[model samples]
Target: MASSPFLNEVRTSIRVRGMSIRTEKTYIYWIRFFIRYNHCRHPTEMGAAEVVDFLGHLATERNVAVNTQRIALNALAYLYNQFLKQPLGDLES
Candidate 1:
């Protein structure tokens, strides 16, 4: 498969902000997982509903712990809120 400049851009953004290597890796991991979970579509095409489903899957089906779920939410928030600059409004309901 071809490379995704988008992921590279995300990585660059994280590094430019002086985030740790581990944090970058974790963020990238979740971002990638989110894309793959949604059938490899670009994140720009997704929105809050997609995010809600992913988080719900993590909580109900995957049975991830609370902190793990929070980490996933944080990763996605950074992707949307910080990198992509697309707000996922009222996601915490």
Candidate 2:
């Protein structure tokens, strides 16, 4: 999956911005999870509504900790805002 062009682009974007390797890995992990959670739909094809659903799933279905959900939200924010150049604009968190 790391070899995929989209993931590679993500990696490149992270590195270009001087993000730590751990941050890179964490962001990639969450991004991949998000993609898989949405049945492999492209992030560019999704937006705030999808993000809201994923976060809701994390809280209600997966029962993740609040901080964990925040981390996932941060990863998606970076993916859209930093990598894809699309601001996610005031998500519910």
Give the TM-score of each candidate. 0.93, 0.93
Give lDDT per model, in order.
0.93, 0.92
Model 2 per-residue lDDT tens digits across residues 1-93: 435789989989999999999999999999999999999999999999899999999999999999999999999999999889999997766
- C-alpha lDDT (0 to 100) for residue 1 of candidate 2: 43
Clashes of 2: 0
Error of 2 at 10 (Å): 0.3
Give the Å shift of residue 24 in candidate 1. 0.3
lDDT of 1 by residue, 1-93 (tens): 443788989999999999999999899989999999999999999999999999999999999999998899999999999999999999766
TM-score (C-alpha, index-matched) for candidate 1: 0.93
Span of 10 residues, lowest total lDDT, candidate 1: 1-10
* Candidate 1 structure lDDT: 0.93
